[model samples]
Target: MRVLGVDPGLTRCGVGVVEGVAGRPLTMVGVGVVRTPADAELGHRLVEIERGIERWLDEYRPERLAVERVFSQHNVRTVMGTAQASAVAMLCAARRGIPVALHTPSEVKAAVTGSGRADKAQVGAMVTRLLRLDAPPKPADAADALALAICHIWRAPAQNRLQQAVAAHRTLKGRTA
Candidate 1:
């Protein structure tokens, strides 16, 4: 499976593409950061984010998009920007009919580093080892994006089965009712 992972931020949105299946080697198709000037108006920044995500979707042709889920932070302003950027990513993927998954920061850290409390350095190290890269990706955001993709590749199968089971149970319950 090919996945495009997005680490959304108003200042520097990270984007990475990875291709692989379970129990197989994964390859980094591409990795980069999308930058929007902080001074830019919010609408302009959002538009920039949309264009960046759309370009990635067109170029990578990913089957799925994994985005970092926005969580509460003391800085409401920061969280709002992150949530906005994340929405832009989801919209871009939805337009192309690609499946989008939102993984929490802890979930991504655990998946890549075997610990939910893993620090940025630990996650970067694990991502480097997993992808067999000589060096960890830079700016922290890039590594984060790759980690999100790796988490989805490893978890999506079981997640899909769980979703199917829930849907089946709902259908059965409705029929009985």
Candidate 2:
């Protein structure tokens, strides 16, 4: 499956595309950052994010979009920008009828590095090795976006099975009732 991963930020939103299934070597289709000037107005920043995300969706046409879930931070201003950028990504995917998956930062770190508390350097190192790249993707954000895609690719199979099992149980219960 081809998945696009987004690490949303106000100034530099990371974007990456990966294609492969679980238990196989994945290919990095593309990786980049969607940068907006910090000095830009709030509305303008959001619009820039939207345009960047839309262009990615149009080009990659990923089957699924994996976005980093916004979490509460001490810096309310920072968190607000992240949430806004994330919303723009979701909106772009929704408009294209692409399925969107939200993964927490910890979840992504654990999936890629075997530790939820792994540092950015460790995550980048693991991502580099996993993707067979000679060097880690530049700017921690870019590497992070690739990591998110890798995490989703590795976890999607189990998640699908769990969903199917829940549905089956519900159907069986309904029949008995």
Candidate 3:
């Protein structure tokens, strides 16, 4: 399955696209960042995010979208903007009738690097090694985005199994008297 992963930040939103089924080294469809002026108004930032995500949807045409969940820390303002970007990304995916999954930054790190508390450099290094790249994906945010996609790929099977079981149960119920 093709997956688009997003790391939402108001100033710089990271996006990565990977395509493949479970347990596979997916092809790198794309990787980049959408930058908006930190001085821009919140409305402007949201617009930028909406447009960026829309473009990604058009370009990647991914089957599923994965995003990093908002983590509230000391920077209340940053958190709010990140949340706004996240909302915009999710909305874009929903409008296209695509499935969206939220993975925490820690979860993404753990899934990719074997440690939830791993640092950005560590995550970047692991991503480089896992994807067999000569260099780590530039800009920590982009690497984080790639890690998010990888996490979703690893997690997709249990979700698919659960979905299949639910569908089977629904079909059985419908056929019953």
Candidate 4:
């Protein structure tokens, strides 16, 4: 499966495309950061983000989109920008009928580095190793985006099975009721 991972930020949103399934070698299809001027109006920034995400979706045509889940931070403004950027990513994918998954920062770290507390350096190093790239992706955001894709690629199979089981159980219970 090809997955596009998005590390959303107002100023520098990371976008990456990876292809592979669980237990198979993965390939990096594309990776880049989307930059918007901090001084840009919020509405204009969001539009720029939307356009960037749409371009990636059109080019890579990923089957799924995995985005970093926005969590609480001390800075409300930062969090709000992140959430808005994330929303644009989700909207872009949804419009294209691609499945979207949100993975927490810790989940992505654990998936890539075997530790939830892994630092940015560790995550970047692991991502470079996993993708078999000679050098790590730059600016941290780029590597984080790749890590998010890797996390989804590894976890989606089990997640799908769990969802199916829950749906079947609900159907059975409803019929009995």
Q: Find the candidate with the highest lDDT and give its number.
A: 4
Error of 4 at 127 (Å): 0.3
Q: Kindly report which residue stretches of model 2 are placed more than 4 angstroms away from their true locations once superposed.
A: 172-177
Question: What range of 10 consecutive residues in model 3 has the weakest lDDT sum?
Answer: 19-28
TM-score of 2: 0.95
Q: 2 or 4: which has the higher lDDT?
A: 4
Q: State each model's CA lDDT, in order.
A: 0.95, 0.94, 0.90, 0.96
Report how far off residue 111 is in candidate 1 (Å): 0.3
Q: Alpha-carbon error at 79 in model 3, in Å?
A: 1.0
Model 1: residue 68 alpha-carbon error in angstroms: 0.8
TM-score of each prediction: 0.98, 0.95, 0.90, 0.98
- Those runs of model 1 whose alpha carbons end farther than 4 Å from true positions after fitting are none
Point out the higher-scoring one by TM-score: 2 or 4: 4
What TM-score should be assigned to candidate 4? 0.98
RMSD of 4: 0.7
lDDT of 3 by residue, 1-77 (tens): 88999999989999999777777776667889989998888898899889998999998899999999998999999
lDDT tens digits by residue: candidate 4, 1-177: 999999999999999999999999899999999999999999999999999999999899999999999998899999999999999999999988999999999999999999999999999999999999999999899999999999999999989999999999999999999
- Clash counts per candidate, in order, are 0, 0, 0, 0
Off by over 4 Å in 3: 163-177
